[model samples]
Target chain A: MQRTPFYQKHLDAGAKMVDFAGWEMPIHYGSQLQEHKQVRSDAGMFDVSHMVVLDLQGAEAKPYLLKLLANNVDKLKESGKALYSCMLNEQGGVIDDLIVYYLSDTAYRIVVNAGTREKDLAWMRQQLQGFDATLTERSDLAMLAVQGPNARAKVFSLMPADEIAIAELLKPFYGAQIGSWFIARTGYTGEDGFEMMFPAEQAEKVWDALVGAGIPPIGLGARDTLRLEAGMNLYGTDMDETTSALTSGLGWTIAWEPANRDFIGRQALEAEKAVGVQQKFVGLVLEGKGVLRSHMKVTCEAGEGEITSGTFSPSLGLAIALARVPVACGEQCSIEIRGKLYPAKVVKPVFVRQGQSVLS
Target chain B: MSNVPANLKYADSHEWILDQGDGTVTIGITDHAQALLGDLVFVELPEVGAQLTAGDECGVVESVKAASDIYAPVSGEVIEINHALEDSPELVNSDPYAAGWIFKLKLDSTAELTGLLTANAYSELVAAEA
Candidate 1:
C-alpha cells in the first residue's frame, strides 16, 4: 500500500490504520467521536496528502478548463479564487468533483479526489488534445487540512511572522502562495481553517508544529462524519461516474449561463433539464431507533429511493442521511433497515454549516 | 493491549457473560470488540422480555465506521436491558463491562456456559487476529 509522508507520524500517534484508495491512511487516533467533536469545537488537523494536485499551465488553460468542467471557469474573476465544479462525460454523468484554483491568467491548480486520480488524469489528458494546456501532477507536495471553530487561530499562531499577514487576509474559497507553501482558506468540515500544501520533506516538521500549537490529528473516520453532517457530497458515495450532478444535490455547482459555449455534456444536460429530473436529492433524519446507512431502501409516497451516504450525526445526536428520492416525495419517508421500516423526516441536504445547525 | 476481564466468560464472537449467581446472567460486548468497532454513535438494544437463542443476532452496535451485530451468547428471555444505551451509546466504548451491559437473561440452560472461552483463551484469540 502507498503511504503518505505523514504515515510514520500517524503511527507515532497511535492511529488505527486503514487502506483508503491504495493509501495506508489513519482511520482514527482513538475515539473518532471525540476527534470529531474536537474539530467542531476546537481545532483538528488532517493529513490529506493522498489527494492529487495538478497544475495546468499555458495560454489555453482558461479555454481548456471551460470546456472540461461543467462549471464555467470564467466565474473565477480574481487570482487566488477557487471554484468547485464537476467534470462530466458525454452522458452528463459526473467524472469527478474537484476544486480549481485560478492561480493566474495562464496557470491554474486543481485538486481531485485521490481514488479517482488515475481516471481523472487520463480524462483531463484526453480533453487536452487540441488545447495548449499542460497538466503536471505535483508528487513532491504534502497537504494538511486544519479545521474547526478555532482552527484558523491555531494554525495562524504557528505561522511565521511574514506569512501571518497574508494568511489572515485570505477569504473563504481563496488561496495564496507564501514562500514554498500554498495555503487556502477552505475546508470540507463546514468550519473555518486552512488547507496547506507544502514540500513533502517538510511535512513532519509542519505537522509537529501544528500539533505543538494545540491542533489534534484527526483520522478519516471523523472526516466522513463531519462532512456528512455538514451536508457535503462525498464524490464516490454521493455521486459517481454513473450519477449526474443535477440529481446528486450538486445542481448549484453547474454553470449554464453562456448559451453558446458547448461543454462536453451540455447537450445531454440540456435534454435532461428539458424532461425534468426524475429523482431529487434530499437529506433525511431518522425519527425512530436504528441508524440509517447507505443503500438502505427509502419508501415514500411517490416511490422508493436509496440512501447514497448516511451516518450518525454526532453534533445533532441523531442519524442523518442523503438520499435520492422521487421528485414528488413529501417530507415524511420510511427507511428499510434490517428488514424493518423506520420513519424519517426529509429536509434540506445541508445539516450543518459553519458549525451551526442548518436544520430547523 | 486489549482488556480481557478475568472474571468474565467470552464467546468467540467477542460477547462477554457475567454469571449473577442466580439463573440469570449479564451480557455485553468485550472491550476488544468495542475498540475494534471504534466510537459508538448509536445502539439498538433488545427489548425486555424478548426471547433469544444462542448465536442469534439480538442487537446492533453502530459506530462512525460501520455497524456490528451483538449476538446472544446464551439462550434465554431478556429480563432487562440497559436503557441508558438508547440515549448514550458511548457507554459501550467508555465502560463496556459494567455500564454497557446490553441485557440480563434468565439462563435457559447452565450447560451453555461450558462453551464460552476463558479470559486467557479470548486474549489468545485477539492476539491471533492482530
Candidate 2:
C-alpha cells in the first residue's frame, strides 16, 4: 500500500484508517458527520495527494489533448487554466475523467483518480505514441484540498503575503505556482478553496500550519458525503469504463460542436444523440425514512435501477443519492432497504453547491 | 478511555448485552461500534416477536460512513426494540449502552450468554485487532 506524505498527520489525528484505491487512507478523524458539517460551515482540509498527477510535455500537447479529451481545449486558452473533461473510449464510454491544466503551449498537467492511474497513463501513452509527448508522473508532489465557505480566507491568511497575492490573482479554473507549491481555485467539495500541491516533504509542515490556523483535518468519510452532497461523481462507484458519460449525468461536459474534429467516442455520442439515450442519471432525496446505499435497488414503473452512490447528506439533513434509471421513470421512486421499500424524490443532480442548497 | 462504561457484557462483534437478571437481556451496539461507524444515520431492526438464533442477522445499523449488520448474540425472540431509533438514530452514538439498546430478548437458554465475551475481554479483542 502506498502512503502519502500526510500519512503521519492522519495517524496523529487519531483518524480511522481504511483502504482506498490501494492506499491506506484516513476515513475520519472522529465523527464523519461533524467533519462534513465542519467543511460546510467552517474550514476543512483533505489530503488528496494519492490521486496521480501526470505532466504531459511535448510539441503536440494541444492537438493531442484536443483529440483525447471530450471538452473543448479552447476552454483553457490562458496558460495555467484548468478544465475538467472525460477521456473516452471510441464507444462514448468514459475511460477516465480527469482535470487538465494548460501549463504551457507544449506542456499540460493532468490529474486522474488513483485507481485508474495505470490505465489512464497507458491509454495516454498509447495515444501520444505517434505524437512526441513525454509523460512524467509527479509522485513527489502532495496535494491538499482546503474547502468550505471559510476555506479560502483561512488558507489565504496563512500563506505568505507574496504567495497570497499571487494566489488571489488566480481565478477559478486557473493555477499559479509560488516556489514549488501550486495553488488552484478548484475543489470537489462545493466551496471556495484551493487545491494546493507542493513537494511531498513539505506536506507535513503545511498540514500542521493549516491545523494551527484552525482548519479541521477532514478524512475520506466526510469527503465522500461532502462530494455526494455537492452532486459530484466518484470514480468506480458512481461511474466506470462500462458506463457512458451521457448516462452518467455528464452530457454538458461533452463538446460536439465543430463537426469535423473526430474525437474518441464522438461517433457513439452522435449516435446516442440522434437515437436518444435510454437511461438518465438523477439525484434522489430520501423523503421517507432510511439511509440510501450504493447498489440498493431504486424502483419505479419505468424499471428498477440501482443507486450508483448514496449516503446521508449532512448538508441536506437527509439521505441523497445518484441513480441511473430508465428515462421513462417517474420523479418518485422507492429504494429497497432490508425488505421494505422507502419512497424518494428525484431532483436535479446538485442538491448543494458553493455551500448553498440548490434545491431550496 | 472507558467511555465504554461497565456493568455490561459485550460481544466481539460489538453488540453489548446487558443482563436484566430477571431472564431477558437488553442488547445494543457498543460505544466502540458507534465510534467506528461515525455518524449513526439509519437502523433496521427485526420486528417484535421474531425469533433469532445466536449470531443471526436481526437488524441493520447504518452510519453515514457505511451500513453494517447487527447480529444477535443471544438466541431468543425480540420482546421489545428501541422505537426511538426509528427517527433519532444518533442515540446509538450518544448513548450506545443505555438509550441505544437495540432489542431485548427472551433468552431460550442462559448458557448462551456465557459464550459472550465480557466488556474487558471485548476491549482486549478490539485491541488485538487494532
Candidate 3:
C-alpha cells in the first residue's frame, strides 16, 4: 500500500494504520470516539495528502471547467473562491464529487477523491483534447485539514508572520496562496478550519508544528463520522458511477439556470427530472435500539429502499444514516436489521452542523 | 498483546467465559476482540429467559466501524445480561474482562467448560491471527 508524506508522524502518534483506497492511512490513533469528539468540540488535524490535487491552467481553463462539471464554474467570479461540484458522466451518473478553487482566470485548483483519482484523471484528460487547458496532478504537495469550532484560530496561531494576516482575512470557501502554501478556509468536517496544501517535503515539519501547538491528529475513522454527521455525501458509499447526483442529496450543487450552458450530464439529468425522480435521498434516525448499518432494507409508504451510509452518530448519541427511499415515502419508515424492523424518522440529510444538532 | 487471564476460558470466536463457581457463568468478548471492533456504540443483548444452543448467535456488538455477532460458546439458559451496555457501550472497550461481561448463562452442561481453550491456548490463537 502507498504511504502519505505524514506516514511517520502517524506511526509516531500510535495510529492504527489501515488500507484505504490503496493508501496505508491511519484509522485512529487510539480511541476513534475521542478523536471524533475532539473535532466536534475542539481542533483536530487530518492527513489528507492521499486526495488527488490537480492544477488546471491555460487560458481555456475556465471554459473547460464550465463544460466538465455539472455545476457552473461561471459563478466563481473572484479568485480564491471555491465551488463544490460533481463531475458526471453522459448518462447523468456521478463520476466523482470534487471541489474546484478558482485561482485565476487561466489557473484553477481541483481536488478529487483519492479512490477515483485514476479514472477522474483519465476522464478529464480525454475531455481536454480540443481545449487548451493543461491538467497537472500535483504529486509534490501535501494536504492537511485542521478542523473544529476553534480550528481557524488555532491554525492562524501557527502561521508565519508574513502569511498570518492573509490567512485571517480568508473567507469561508476561499483559498489563498501564501508563499508556497495554499491555505483554504474549507474542510470536510462542518467546522471552521483551513485545508492547508503545501510542499510535500515540509509535511513532517508542518505536522510537528501543529502537534506542538496541541492540535490532536485525527484519523479517517473520525473523518467519516464527522462528515456523515454534517450530512456530507461520501463519494463511493453515497453515490458512484451507477448513481445520479439528483438521487444523492446533491441536487443543489447542480446549476440548472442559464439553460444554454450544456455540461456533460445535462441532457440525461433533464430527462430524469422530466420523467419524475423515483428515489429520493434523505437522512434517517433510528428511533429504537441497534445501530443502523449500510445495505439495511428501508420500507416506507412509497416502497422499499436501502441505506447508503449509516453509523452511530457520536454527536447525537444515536444511530443516523443517509438512505435512498422511494420519492413518495413520506416522513416515516421502518428499517430492517437482523430480521427485525425498527422505526426510523426521515429528516433532511443534515443531522448536525457547527457542533450543534439541527434536527427538529 | 491482548489480556488472556489464566483463569478464564476462551472460545475460538473471541468470547471469554468466566465460570462464576455457581451453576451460572459470565461471558463477554476478549480484549483483542474489543480492540478489533474499535469503539462500540451499541450492543444488542439476548433476553434473560432465552435458551441458546452452542454456537447460536444470541447478540450483536455494533461499533462505529462494523457490527459483529455475539455467539453462544456453550448451550445455556440466559440468566442475566449487562444492562449498562445499552447506554454506554464503551464499557466493553474499557473493561472487557470485568465490568464489561455481556451475559450470565446457566450452563446446560458443565462439561462444555472443559471443551473451551485455556488462556495459553487462546493467547496462541490470537498471536497466530496477528
Candidate 4:
C-alpha cells in the first residue's frame, strides 16, 4: 500500500492504520471521538497528502475550465481565488467534485479527491485534445489541513514573519503563495483553517512544527465525523458517477447563467431541470435512539429515499445523515434501521458552522 | 495486545463470558471487539428472560463509526441486563469486561461452556486476527 510522507509520524503518534483508497492512512491516533472533540474545540492537523493536486497551464486554461466545470471559473477574476465545482460527464453524472484555484489566465491549480485521481486525470486529459491546456500532476507535493476554531492562529504561529503577513491577509476561499508553500483558507470541516501544500520532502518538518505548536494530528476517522457533523458530503458515499450534481446537494455549484456556457453537463442538467428535478438532497436528524447509517431506507409522506451518508453527530449528540429523498418530501421522515423505522427531522443540509450548531 | 482476562471463556465472534459457577453467568463483548467498534453511542440488548441460541445475534452495539451485532456466546435465558448503557453506551469502550457487561444469562447446560476457547486460546485467536 502507498504511504504518505507522514506515515512514520502517524505510527509514532499511536495511529491506527487502515487501508483507505489504496493508501495506508491513519483512521485515528487513539480515540476517534476524543480527537474529533479536540478539533471541534481547539486545533488539529490532518495529513491530506493522498489528495491529488493537478496544475493546469496553457493559454487556453480559462476557456478549457469554462467548458470543464459545472461552476463557472469566469467568476474567479482575482488571482489566488478558489472556486468549488463538480466535473460532470455528458449525462450530468458527477465525475468528481473539486476545488480549482485561479492563479493566472494561463495557470490554475485543481485539487481532486484521492480515490478518483486516475479517473479524473484520464477524463480531463481526454477533454484537453483541442485546447492548449496542459495538466501536470503534482505528486511531489504534500498537503496538510489545519482546522478548527483556533486553527488559523495555531498555524500562523508556526509560519515565518513574512509568510504570516501574507497568510493573515487571505480571506475565505482564497490561497496565496508564501515562500515554497501554497496556503489556502479553505477546509472541509466547516472550520477556519488553512490547507497548506509544500514539497513532499518537507512534510516531516512541517508536521513536527505544527506539533510543536500544539496542533494534534487527527486521523481520517475523526475527519469523517467532523465533515458529517458539518453536513458536508462524502464523494463515494453521497454521490458518484451515477448521481447528478442536481441530486447531490450541490446545485449551487452549477452556474446556469451566461445562458450558453455549454459546459459538459449543461444540456443534461438543463433537461433534468426542465422536467423538475425528481429528488432532493437533504439533511436528516434522528428524533430518538439508534444511529442512522448509509443505505438505510427512509420514508416520508412524499415517498421513499436512501441515506447516502449517516453517523452519530459528535457535535449535535444525535444521529444525522445526508439523504436523497423525493422532491416532495416533507419536514418529517422515518429512517429504517435493522428492520425498524425511526423518526427523523428534515433540516437544511448544514448542521454546524464555525464550531457551532446552525440547525434550527 | 487486547485484554483477555485469564478466567473467562471466549467466543470466536469476540464475546466473553464469566461463569459464576452457578447456572448463571455474565457476558459482554471483548476488549478487542470494543476497540474495533470505537466509541459506543447506543446499545440494544435482549429483553430479560428472552431465550437465546448460541451464535444467534441477541443484541447490537452501535458506535460512531458503524454498528456491530452482538452474538450470544452460549444459549441461555437473559436474566438481567446493564440498564446504565441505555443512557451512556460508552461504558462498553471504557469498561467492557466489568460494568459494561451487557447481560447476565442462565445457562441451559454446563456442557456448553466447555466448547468456548480458554483465555490462552482466545489470546492466540486475537493475535492471529490482528
Model 4 Cα displacement at A297 (Å)? 0.4
**TM-score of the second chain in each model?**
0.98, 0.95, 0.98, 0.98
Docking class of 4: high
Cα deviation at A74, candidate 4, in Å, is 0.4
Question: What lDDT tens digits, residue by residue, belong to model 2 across residues B64-97?
Answer: 8688999999899899999999988999989888
Clashes of 4: 0
Report the Cα lDDT for residue A151, model 2: 86
Worst 10 residues of 3 chain A by lDDT: A153-162
lDDT, candidates in the order shown? 0.93, 0.88, 0.94, 0.93
Residue clash pairs of candidate 1: none
lDDT order, best first, reads: 3, 4, 1, 2
Tens-digit lDDT string for candidate 3 (B1-130): 7888999999999999999888788999999999999999999999999999989999999999899999999999999999999888899999999989999999999999999999999999999999
Better of 2 and 4 by lDDT: 4
lDDT of 2: 0.88
The TM-score, computed over Cα atoms with residue i paired to residue i, of candidate 3 is 0.99
A45-95, model 4: which lDDT tens digit per residue? Answer: 999999999999999999999999999999998889999999999999999
For candidate 2, give the DockQ.
0.80
Ranking by DockQ: 3, 4, 2, 1
State the lDDT of candidate 3 residue by residue for A1-360, as single tens digits.
999999999999999999999999999999999999999999999999999999999999988998999999999988899999999999999999999999888999999999999999999999998999899999999999999998888877887777888988899999999988999999998988999999999999999989888898999999999999999999999999899899999999999989899999999999999999889999999997678878999999889999999999999998999999999989999999989899999999999899999999
Each candidate's number of clashing pairs is: 0, 0, 0, 0
Task: Return the top candidate by lDDT.
Answer: 3
The residue-level lDDT of candidate 3 at A1 comes to: 91
Q: Which residue pairs show backbone clashes in model 2?
A: none
